[model samples]
Target chain A: MFVQATESSTGVSHDVARLGRLVRGLPETALVVDAITGLGTTDLQPDEWGLDIVIGGSQKALMVPPGLAFLGVSEKAWKLIERSKLPRFYFNLARERKAQSKSEVSFTPATTLVVALHTALEYIRSMGREKLIANAAMLAEATRAAASALGLGLFAESSPANALTAVSAPAGMDSGAIIKELRARFGAIVANGQGSMKGKIFRIAHLGYYDAPDMFALIASLEIVLTKLGHTCELGAGVARAQEVYLGFVEQEAQAAQAGRP
Target chain B: MFVQATESSTGVSHDVARLGRLVRGLPETALVVDAITGLGTTDLQPDEWGLDIVIGGSQKALMVPPGLAFLGVSEKAWKLIERSKLPRFYFNLARERKAQSKSEVSFTPATTLVVALHTALEYIRSMGREKLIANAAMLAEATRAAASALGLGLFAESSPANALTAVSAPAGMDSGAIIKELRARFGAIVANGQGSMKGKIFRIAHLGYYDAPDMFALIASLEIVLTKLGHTCELGAGVARAQEVYLGFVEQEAQAAQAGRP
Candidate 1:
């Protein structure tokens, strides 16, 4: 069964653990997860949660350039691969695995990209995976808080994604205008809604390769853009709110570390 | 209307100036130059040569990761774009130029890659463009000399590119085996020939972000891999030849500078 663990367009993450529980009832079914934008942002335990396959992209939380996609295929998925009759060529996972066994690629891989990914992975390891996750989550929370403080409504109500925050444009205002103003006036470019949601919502990304200062600068630029577009909002309102949220996160982490002290 | 100026597959570069002269003969024609692997490794005067369009890739001479491609479109090409009725959206050079004029992108740009490219560009500027090209040319000469010293033949008969050296593998020896041995024994990865040339030739790259020590190390590894693969070549034979070529280049440059003295 194919499932989108994280919907990139809407920035909504599905509960993989709960999905795993449901998939367990169907013994013949193999769960495939689209974790392209979810890998580094959320806590996804493919092994523990019994996920058959998890797909990832390099440009997301990996902090590397695009052109590389990663697949985590469990032993269960290997059995399916052995029996599956799908037409396969360049994306043949089995062939890739055979080459990987020899610490090589089946074809001419993107050499410089692989080198960049290696550096990015090393950086993630040095930062501690849990802390990196926490950092992303905190940044996402700050973005939400900042948007709320600016009197903007979030597009994702039920389950927001840590990778990005999708906020609705003010009533009757085109999100494209705000996006344009942000780039033209402030030299900041945020994503406008895709497809049907275009001109209705704007997104602020807080995924890998982003930090507190980036979020702060984004929020500040957003405030300036919004105000210039005739939206009545106090100056520095979003930035101040984001700063408060970030400081609160740091304080909570510090307190938790202090409590865990032996 | 479309022409490949630099053929990276065979490490051959066509004379763009000569091609431009022919292209100018046809009023409606526009010359497009593929400078992907050629940029930063050679002196390419697009403006002076009247090239209409030039395409470059970030992963090559820019020393950045992939996912970003650069296009240098002349005013002539812009006129062609206005008249040419091709259904264009993502790869639309007109839209890209508009965005670039404002120092922005039409879509979500590769943020980390752009930042890295900025640093790499700054480094290149500090090194001076002409000197960088000279360095690559010298390195290419050394690689060719080293390959020749090992009794390997050059693949490109005319206009060899400074970016990489394509040399034929020894008689009855597979280039793939040499590439494999290099990676397996010394953790050094080199490129084997592509397509019909597979198992026949090997490539040594001397593009951007590489220097003397890098070439020296690569030559040493090649010697080791060749010896291990039963090639009856003396150890350090290739390295000594490469060192001699490099020193000769330095001496020529020094003598040229002295001759130019006022």
Candidate 2:
């Protein structure tokens, strides 16, 4: 069974832990999670949660240009894959796994991107993967606080994704106008809602290569653009809220360290 | 049905045209061709010969780093693919084809290598693909002539591949010795025989990025290495024969051009 750890299109996070529990007793079932948007930003434990497979992409929170996908497979998945009649064609997982064991690939690989990914992964490792995920969560919290302060209704208010924050346009306003204004005025391009959600909500990413400063700048820009597009808001409310979130987060970290929490 | 346009293993060229003819009577069968080493170095016509699919790689003859694979799928192949029960996994040709029709990819592609491949393909197109193939053939011809002059037995004498030429070890001499000696003496590394053919024959590639000067240098190095390894041959004889082949090919090309052949 395939599950999405985070639904990027809707800016909602999936209850992946519940999914593992739902299929724990089924020996034949394999839970494959699409964690492309979740891997770096969300705290995911595929193995501990008994997920059979988790898929990720390079361009998401990994902060690289698009072109590679990563897969984390459980032993159960491998066993099932061995018996699978599916003609693997080019994406032969078994072949890839065997080759990867030897630090080789079954087929040609993107050398340059792999090198870039190596550097990024090394950096992530140095900083700790958990830290990266925490960074995303902090950014998301800040963005959410700013959105609330600016009187913007968030699209996924109940369970907003850490990868990005989606803010819904106010009454009678198209999100496209805000999106265009942000790009035109500040040269900062944000994502619009995909498919049917288009023109209803604009998304602000807080994933890879983003920090507290970037969030501050983005939130500030959003405020100006929203007002210019006729959706008036408090001039400095968004940035101010984000700054408060940052300061609060730093204090929490310090308190946790002082408390000797590993 | 599947066939190879050229077998890089033993440096033998397959009669792909004959294979196409042999399978012409089988309407339900789709002939697939592996043209990885053959693509830019050999003349192949997948459309005309009713080949259902032709596979190629970026590093072979295309003058690009290894990262991408190319496939030419005919209408028959698509029809066959539609009926195929094999789970395509990541190598879903149908999904890829649909996306590619609009110049989009279904999966994350290696962005940097794709860019590199695009640049290499553009260069190949500007130079004309036929010229590249002819150049390979000319280099192979020169290498073959040189090998013969040096008293080295051609492994694929009857059907030598245009991609590369394989030369057998001379009388009780292991091909590995000559390969090592050449590398040690001149820093020129040639491929040793694979699998069962190892220690018996060594391969000299005449494919991508190779020209007359390269061939001359390679052959001269081989002559010295062979002598050092207890095999003796006239030093300038191999180079002279290669020069003759180079001149002959140029004259033939000029004559063909003058005769209004495209």
Docking class of 2: medium
Candidate 2 clashes between residue pairs 3 or more apart in a chain or in different chains: A67-B109, A86-B87, A87-B87
lDDT of 1 by residue, B1-262 (tens): 6666666677776788898888867767889988888788888888888888888877877888665677888888789887888766677787878888989778656666678889989998998888878988999999988888887889985778899888888899998998898889888767888779989988888888789889999998888888888887878988998899889989998998899999
Estimate candidate 1's RMSD in Å.
7.7
Q: What TM-score against the true fold does each predicted structure earn? A: 0.63, 0.86
lDDT of 1 by residue, A77-96 (tens): 88878788876677688989
Which one is best on TM-score?
A: 2
DockQ of each: 0.18, 0.54
Give the poorly placed runs of model 1, Cα more than 4 Å off: A1-262, B1-3, B184-188, B216-230, B233-240
How good is model 1 by TM-score? Answer: 0.63
List, residue by residue over B1-262, the lDDT tens digit for candidate 2: 8778888888999888778876766767888889989899888988777777899988789877766787999887788789898755567898898888989787667677778888888988998899999999999998889888889999999998899999998989999998999888889989899879999999998888888898899999888888888788999999999999999999998998899955
